[model samples]
Target: MSAPPRVPRTRPEPVAPDPAVPEPAVPEPTLSELAVSEPAAAEALDAHEEHAWSRCDPWSAALRSGRGPLYLHREDGTRHPLDIERWCAAPDAADRTVIERCRGSVLDIGCGPGRFLVALAERRLTALGIDANPHAVARAVRAGGGALCRSVFAPLPGTGSWHTALLVDGNIGIGGDPPRLLRRTAELVRPGGTLLVETAAHALDERLSVRVGDGRGVHGTAFPWARLGSTALLRHAEETGAWAKAGEWEAGGRRFVALRRA
Candidate 1:
């Protein structure tokens, strides 16, 4: 397995366009703009699609889908229909309440553009977000939020230190290594901390097994991402003896299960 460390340590350059691909008009979107302006999000996503079609990482462009937490690059130097908020997990009022109940600093894994962190911050919680994709992290940082351009499975600056950890967007299977990923997430959060792992309560087959390609693509198994439903995930939580189910909720089209120390 050539899986790179999931620690938030490695620094990579943000994705840019190739000469073969002409840049499309994708003006950056502010968090507020993205939050309320669905039309703008839709437009930006279309531009991303265009960029992918232009051969920016051609293989990934071929794998590009208009859905998921992925942002694609098209041939016209534009990105595609971006799924700002994915289908299964939604950071709605329920998630907001759970975040408010957090005891200390919070860590949001797979924080894309820091939208969730920004929302968490509004509630006066110290939150941090990390992602493997430099572009996403950079966007979050540029938008004035605390986001790291690194992987979640890698060593964290402050390990076993946070009171709350977020693993929404079916992050339990990050890097397609479920057990290691769960253990690593546990290591990052304090013993009594809560790791809010979200997935499809009904369609979980896609969340358990991941199949990432290269260092720049994503293709998880078709499982619905039910970390809560998996016996292995349950075992991982028990073996750690650090977390137990604390909170859970469902909205839009997903389910969330928050695990904390017993």
Candidate 2:
């Protein structure tokens, strides 16, 4: 038989890229191909902080692309459509089950546009979202959803907060420092609280790191800016001493883990 599949030996560590190998030049994407690709993930932030460009710029092109499904927090401050509505609207038994199991307040880390928060609010559960983008926060508020304008690594606005916090859409990348990211998340979660994380496709180094910027910007093996993967996520949980276990959803091509403070 061919060699057995390579199980992860240990969590993959992302060392900084060497200075000798210049960061690749990511070409500005085509403004014309908005229909072909899905949008990339972005934590909400304010307008001025975001770049002003259209289809020609890497960020805007990627945002407008149909490459990956997305929930847009429009630059115009109006509620744009979100591709995640299908799932967020009709949470499967697995997700509903998790919701039913949750106790006390809830928070959605990197809560983009308050989609989850609004859904949870409908369920009559107390919920909030915290994202790095001020523009996103404003849109969320305008959308009549509640969320915080802050980065994941920053301290939460309130203490001894919620019993359950979510990190969905491969959002485990809270600054490319998984261990510290986990520790901070755990701290934000109160005693007996649980952190529910949704992970990206596995064997992360290549498939996940293909973020093409202007080619002049920094390229990272792990996301110091955006989403991240399972290895770094699990490793961070371990390092932070959070009791953790992963649940793989093979049919959906995703995996999620729940970690609780021990």
Output the number of the lDDT-best candidate.
Answer: 1
For model 1, residues 3-92, the per-residue Cα lDDT tens digits are 222222322222222233222222221223212211121122222122211122322222233134354333233433334444223356
Report clashes for each candidate as comma-separated counts.
40, 14
TM for every model, in the order presented, reads: 0.58, 0.57
| Worst 10-residue lDDT window, candidate 2 | 3-12
The TM-score obtained by model 1 is: 0.58
Write down the lDDT that model 2 would get. 0.48
Candidate 2 TM-score versus the reference: 0.57
Best candidate, TM-score = 1
